[model samples]
Target: MLKNKKLAVIGVGKLGEALISGLLKRNAVEASDVTGSVAHEPSISRVKERLNINVTLDNCEAIKGKDVILLAVKPQNMDRVLKEISSSVKPDQLVISVAASVTTSFVEERLPDGIPVVRAMPNTPSVINAGMAGLCAGANASEDHKSMAEAIFKCVGETVFVDESLMDGVTALSASGPAYLYVVIESLAEAGVKLGISRETSTLLAAQTMLGSAKMILDSKQHPAMLKDMVTTPAGCTIDGLMELEEGKLRVTLIKAVVKAAERARELVNTQTSKFSK
Candidate 1:
């Protein structure tokens, strides 16, 4: 879907670089057709060296004539970047914003009317083409527009469409999920180390187990609890471990963590919308 499209990524940070790298690696877009904008002169060289794409300090220059513009800026900097490129963004082009807590309406309000805006929350795993993204379309967006946006994210990993209202939950569960999972993996690895296992092997076991478990969930399409039951036989070692997790309130802790993150993301929605809703 994006083979012929011109992609302009504003803010060639880690996520941006990862997306560009995924697109290029998958031959979705040619390096020559991609352009990226960086905040500093030094970053210009860094992005150029990393992606070998056209790098510019000017956001306008980077976006000029682009078919799809990915706003990869931080949420706090969204307003400034939107204002900087608002005059240059054409209605015919598609705008995809990956900034957490920044809504499609927020981008739409700052841009020309009829411009299609897609709000996507993709996690750090996108850097490796194993990412998960949840997307929602703005009022002006159409099925075609959503497809275009989906195609872009598909280059990196899975994409799911959800109601805009549920995006805060997606942000909390997926966008912030990797960090939480990393903590779990680290704790598991630590448990192994305490048992006298080598740190490297312990880490590999913990990380791969997590990956395999996630894959089973996706591929089998079964309830995670069912899968957990499969390993947790009568009075088994797995049950003992599960008991410890339950005793430590791991499940509720994770649920509360996601809830807390969603609260913060919702708060950001208010802060972000108030800026442009006026």
Candidate 2:
């Protein structure tokens, strides 16, 4: 969808760098078609040198004449960045924001009315093209805008479209899910170490198991429960492990954590809206 498009990424941090790299790696956009806006001299210099793309400290200059503008800045810095570029953003340009708490309305309020906006929650996994991204469009956004958003995200990872209301849940699940997985990996690794496995080997086993399990879910087309049941023979070792997890209320804990995180994401959005209102 971004073929031959002039795109500007208005944050050159790790996520921004990842998106840029993904786009180029996937041939989504050519080097000359991409530009980066960053405040840190080192990041700007490094991205420019590595990608051979345009990089500037000025957000407005970076976005000028761009067909797509990616708002990759931190939530707190969004207002300042928008203020810096609002005057230059063309009315027809599509704005895609990956900011955690910044909603579509939050972004639209900063730009001219009628401009298309898409709010996406893409995880750290996007850095590796294995990420899952949840996307939503503003009231003014057209189908074409949605398609563009999907195309861009699909290049880096899987993309799912949902109502803007569910974005908070998406944020809690996929965007914050990596940290949860990391904790799980660490815990499992520690358990392995306690069971006499070397720390290095335990870490590798934990990571590979995660990778393999994810692949199975994607490839099998079988329900996850079905897959689990297939491994769980009657009175088997797998069943014993499952019993231990059940005793710890693992599923309940995860469900509660997801619910709490979603609520917190909603609170963050409300807070941003409140602060902007004031």
Candidate 3:
């Protein structure tokens, strides 16, 4: 979908590099067709050397006349970056933001109206092209614009369209979900060490099990509950472990953690809107 498109990434951080790498590996856009901007001189040089793409420290120069502008900067610096590029962004250009808690409305307010914009929340797994991104389009975005955003994200992993209002929940779920998974993995590794396994072996065992389990769920086409039942034979060791988990209220606690994280995401959104308004 991005064939021959003039694309510019406004950051060369970890997430930005992953996105650019994914785009190149997928042949979504040629290296010559992509440009990047960074705050420092060394980062600018580093992206150019690493990705063989155009790099600049000037945010406006990177965005100028680009068909698609990706705002990959941090939320704290979003206002400064947007304002810097606002005058140069044309009505025909499409702006895709990967910054969390910064809404399309907030972007539009800072830029010229009628410039298409899409807000996306993508997590750290995107660094490995195994990410899930939740997308929300702005009022001025056209179907073609939305499709381009979808295609770009799909190159890295899965993309889901949701109402802008629900983007915070999406952020809380899939965007923040990787950290939750990491916590689980860490705890399991510690448990393994306690059970007499070497630390390195326990880490590898826990990670591989999690990876295999996720793949099984994806490839099996069976409900997770059914899959669980398949492992829990009548009066088996698996069932004994399951009973222990239930007794400890593990499922309930995990559900509550997700809820709390989603609430925190919503709070951040509210705070961002309020701060921008002020």
> Candidate 2: lDDT of 211?
91
Return the top candidate by TM-score: 2
Question: In candidate 1, what residue range of length 10 has the lowest lDDT sum?
Answer: 269-278
Selected candidate, larger lDDT, 2 vs 3: 2
- Per-residue lDDT of 1-278 in model 2, one digit per residue for the tens? 68889999999888888888888999989999998988877877798887889999888888888999999988888988887788788888999999998888888898887889999999999999998999999988999999998999998899999999999999999999999999999999999999999999999999999999889999988899998998999978999999999999999999999999999999999898777656
Report the C-alpha lDDT of model 3 over 199-263, residue by residue, as the tens digit.
89999999999998888998998888988998888977998888889999999987888788888
Segments of candidate 3 deviating more than 4 angstroms: none
* Model 3 residue 76 lDDT score: 77
Q: Can you write out model 1's per-residue Cα lDDT over 1-278, one digit (the tens) per residue?
A: 88789999999999999999999999999999999998889998899898999999899999999999999988878888999999999988999999988888788888888899999999999999999999999998889989999998999999999999999999999999999999999999999999999999999999999999999999999999999999988977998888888899998999999999999999988977786455
| Residue 206 shift from truth in candidate 2, angstroms | 1.6
RMSD of each: 1.5, 1.2, 1.4
Candidate No. with top lDDT: 1
Q: Please list the C-alpha lDDT of all candidates, in the order they appear.
A: 0.93, 0.91, 0.89
Choose 1 or 2, whichever is better by TM-score: 2
Ranking by TM-score: 2, 1, 3
TM-scores, one per candidate: 0.96, 0.96, 0.95
